[model samples]
Target: MEIFLALLGFFSLGLIVWLLLKDYATPALAFISVSISVACILLILEQLGFGVGAA
Candidate 1:
């Protein structure tokens, strides 16, 4: 899905940011990025009226 892909991209971007800030520690960056992306995707979906079978 387009939304899913966007979410993944957002997470990847966050991971990159984290890595930059933390000097390239992939593990911690990956976890924080995933959490941020999931939260952002859920929020966007809810706002768009496509969340939880509402579409």
Candidate 2:
């Protein structure tokens, strides 16, 4: 699971870079997209009994 998240985070960084390079999104928009996508994934994982807790 940790490995999966690590890879996801890695690709997510790449995704932001790609977006910025293409001028497809402002920095703020790219941040929002990545953050929201990660949040949604976490929610889905929790629903599937793969809970991750925040302290």
Candidate 3:
């Protein structure tokens, strides 16, 4: 699980890098979108009992 999260984080950051490489509408939007995506991903994982508080 830890490794999975690490990889997911790397992939998320890489997505930002890719967006930065192109002419995205704005950096702010890209960051906001990715942040939201990460948040949702974490929440989903948590619901599946893979989060910090999971037993």
Q: How do the residues 1-55 of candidate 3 rate in per-residue lDDT, one tens digit apiece?
A: 6756665676577567657754755777766667665665675577567877532
Q: What is the lDDT of every predicted structure here?
A: 0.68, 0.63, 0.64
Residue pairs in collision within model 3: none
Give a tens-digit lDDT track for model 2, residues 1-55. 7755665676577566656654766787767667665665675466557857730
For residues 1-55, could you state the per-residue lDDT of candidate 1 as single tens digits? 6876776678678766766766556677667766786676675686577788532
Off-target runs (Cα >4 Å) in candidate 1 are 1-23, 53-55
Winner of 1 and 3 under lDDT? 1
lDDT of 1: 0.68
Better of 1 and 3 by TM-score: 3
Candidate order (lDDT): 1, 3, 2
Worst lDDT 10-window in candidate 3: 46-55
Q: Rank all candidate structures by their TM-score, best first, as comma-separated numbers.
A: 2, 3, 1
The predictions' CA RMSDs to the true structure, in order, are 6.2, 6.4, 6.3
Of 1 and 2, the candidate ranking higher by lDDT:
1
Candidate 3 segments whose C-alpha is farther than 4 A from its true place: 1-22, 53-55
Can you give the TM-score per candidate against the true fold?
0.49, 0.54, 0.52
Maximum-lDDT candidate? 1
